[model samples]
Target: MELNRTTCYIASLRSSSVSRGYRRIIKGFTAYADVCFREFGNHVKFWTTINEANVFTIGGYNDGTSPPGRCSNCSSGNSSTETYIVGHNLLLAHASVSRLYQQKYKDKQGGSVGFSLYAFEFIPQTSSSKDDEIAIQRAKDFFYSWILGPLTFGDYPDEMKRAVGSRLPIFSKEESEQVKGSSDFIGIMHYFPALVENIKLKPSLSRNTDFYSDMGVSLTYLGNFSGFGYDVFPWAMESVLEYIKQTYGNPPVYILENGTPMKPDLELQQKDTRRIEYLQAYIGAVLKAVRNGSDTRGYFV
Candidate 1:
């Protein structure tokens, strides 16, 4: 059987979903990607990072969804907090290999490599006043900061500094540069909108509540989680595309995933109308972004 490299998508070894208590699992698969450049120093053309690191918070951390199905490291409990650390460790592990490939094959022709990050959209509620700002920042602080800050700036988002305190790990200056330095493109896996507003911590889950669920703030409020709240706003997709373009210096972007889940209503088909519209709006944003000189190369919906 002839293998079609073009259609080949390799599982990432750096992520625990594939790494599974391993030492350098990806090393074995590089050959299959035909990543070898030269019998005599010739370089391979291109590469991409593991499937999508951004979904870890949602799947691995929050909902106990997908493989290795405990609520993830990014959650609030002692166990979940440890899981968040584990998640970061996994990210660093992946980053190490990403850097290794670039270093080992500097002379490669037309070489470009990157990874996908899932970005969840957020909208602040109107009635909450200034508390909404804190809520929005927390969400940004929780999700976007981890991937974006380090990938583009060589540091985790500063807001996380307060959250994790001394538990937060530090990178040496060299390592910091390495973390920020490795991207040739930004991979985006965006889906759905969220409404953020301050909510007082409930007594039963107060400490852990803020920890895992990341409550809006001290003020009283309510709003969206993945499926429950995405229906309210649709324009924010454009904001997300534009935000990426501006923040990441307009580096090329490949949207590796951007789909929504369907409601389980009887009338609905697996065709998932909400998911389809979600995709359409986001794709429209991508087009508008490209036309506006945003260097958005392509997207996979």
Candidate 2:
């Protein structure tokens, strides 16, 4: 609690929390940011406010797989509401922290604060099916636009609002203004791609549908994704960069994390030609995107 925020300071602090056993994000994150900047901003050049924000929220709040693990099927959770609420708080916290750095620390520290999300190159299940083609956009709305829409345009994707309905949180005018241009860069974490299939889920009488259900798309990954290494599809990286370029006005981007996982065998680890090829292919993809006019500033492996 102490590490998270200044919960102790606000004696009257009360959260209108919709998620079970979780208070709405209040002061802990920005307070922690302030401390980190005061102590380390002089040396740090890039500060990413959150890492893999979307995936983290969905895993923890909707899938019951991470910290504060809670979901509809768990002992206590409302996957329908908590995922959206938690994701909203993450955006709010990033905005607050970014604003703080810009106002109080930027002039003196010469540092940048950025926002991050895990990105997948979403493809249609069938190349010829119009429904599958459209489903790719729907998947992007939930996976990409859920974070970038507000950062770039000050609102959630219209599709998301229509689908999630009242469960999706709304940013007030002030929040919209604050979150719109809060980041110095858009950080992307990429490794693989997903094939998106449109699903017509029958209307549930109960209000317990999770984020995936709300998005109305199913994502299936290709390859042996159980840490044996990732399948290389460099074109997907180029496609992602292209989408961001056309959709979000070519914001400055950084590939914060991108790497293939390998099995834990010492012999294979030592003879790691696969990882080399992965890096080479992805780097080539980034170079291709750059040639095609993506404002991608950096990449990390």
Candidate 3:
């Protein structure tokens, strides 16, 4: 189906008045999810409420790289604040829908609901400095814990709370109760690992920071080449799984997207040797994590 300009504009959810619009967006999303559950609950046993929720907020609100494309310098948007606000609303919407299904349809449908997050295995650039090591943990908190913390522990990580301060939205007692432990499983989309370097933010910039700025670290992507390329690093997948297992109580996980991208060459596509090797190695990494009791349930390419 094609979306007209008006529909696309409204669906963008990009408004001059963000706070009020955020509430309406959440309400609309939850109502839509309720309809889908009532219509498809019997046929679909596993429902992923939102795919890459973290990336959607970050890319759309902070970086201006996705739909509705708003950023600090864009025609509209507060990169630092809007990203957090959008993320907060997305979580509330997901939890509300999950609760609706659990209360009304779960017993009869016997279905499970979860949400996906974009994950990266972060490694310190230099092992010599304690600062880099600390930065690594902080990056993880900003990237993974921003969402997982609420799902697993009922709130955002303390580091994030302290970093974002008032810009970050607060959850009430009842909202917290509903958000905590809302998902039956957590879906992860991991492509590569990043070498994290410690970076000190200027005091002025610190006063007005975006998500990456608040992270207080620089990420260098490494693989077959610099920048973006066909880089296959299976060990990164193993590290990510292990981190989730050791830190997040090893919840049920599905490798929702773990594949190597290739150019659209008919001959190369027909052969597809690199793709096969990538899958084999990554699947092996998943097996290692599962054998080590990581509670990983499935892998999808």
Candidate 4:
């Protein structure tokens, strides 16, 4: 079971009562995880240490839209650097907790530990343009690899290192050893796909850049920016599963969150035909991915 919602770091960073740096945060979070493991490990066979690590770092540090509200122009926080710093600390913290579980509790408890990331199926805005196609991959590198790369391969993606330069955190030999192969499974929280359009790097790079600016791509959602409406696109789910299978050695995956939000209409909420159809289509897509050997193990909404 997933214990933390937006991750311990995000919550702690948001809390006005708590003010700590990355190292302190990691130490505190690892201790907290130890307590949870000691208390819940016997009954819970599957544990997710953090939820949406990528989104938390991005929304909180990069955009300053979430808790702590720190950005380049905000009252505090460095959008360009803090995101990577927090992300690096999270990877190390998650690895430490997973190692604790494996060494101390796995055999006795018969439980597994995993990490979760916010995932989006990105489609190129212009299918014919080679740059657009490449931008789609760059976006993935910035978004998915920002977290998954360290967990899977012990370092951030080469593309990310090149793009973010010194802003991206570095992993030492020991930290890399601890971070790699840290998870038994990966949890994905996907909603809808985003159309990725290639952008010129010179303009964004000439000025101060955040995560999206580093990726050199713009994400356009099909519907409103507000969370009130959604358009079901099951193909995006299938594509994301397939991409993960091909890119990440087909690790076990759990669909931790997938759903649509509707407005506060009592009659429509009672009926909810659209939501039902959305679920059915997405489940079908998951089945299709499994049939194609995606190694998807669980689904949650």
Across 1-301, the per-residue lDDT of candidate 4 in tens digits comes to: 5333222333454422222244776677778888877887766777887788888778777788877677787788777888888778878888988888888888888877889998899988989989999999998998888888888889999999998898887899999999999989999999989999998866644657788888889999765647686788889999999998998889999998998777788887679787778889999999999999999999999
Question: How much is 213 displaced in model 3, in angstroms?
Answer: 1.5
| lDDT to native, each model | 0.57, 0.81, 0.81, 0.82
Q: Across residues 146-207, which tens digit of lDDT does each residue of candidate 1 receive?
A: 67777788888777766666655676787687777567777776666666776766568555
Sorting all predicted structures by TM-score, with the top scorer first, yields 4, 3, 2, 1
Worst 10 residues of 3 by lDDT: 2-11
TM of each candidate vs. truth:
0.70, 0.89, 0.90, 0.91
lDDT of 2 at 123: 84
Q: How many angstroms is residue 21 displaced in model 3 relative to the true structure, after the best TM-score fit? A: 6.2
Q: Write the per-residue lDDT of candidate 3 for residues 159-187, one digit (tens) a residue.
A: 99998899899999999999999989888
lDDT of 4: 0.82
User: What are the candidates' C-alpha RMSDs?
Assistant: 6.2, 5.2, 4.6, 2.9
Q: Which ten residues in a row have the lowest lDDT in candidate 2?
A: 1-10
Point out where model 1 deviates above 4 Å: 1-46, 72-78, 200-205, 209-234, 260-281
Clashing pairs in 4: none
TM-score: the better of candidates 1 and 4: 4
Off by over 4 Å in 2: 1-24, 204-207, 264-271
Model 1, CA-based lDDT: 0.57
Clashing pairs in 3: none
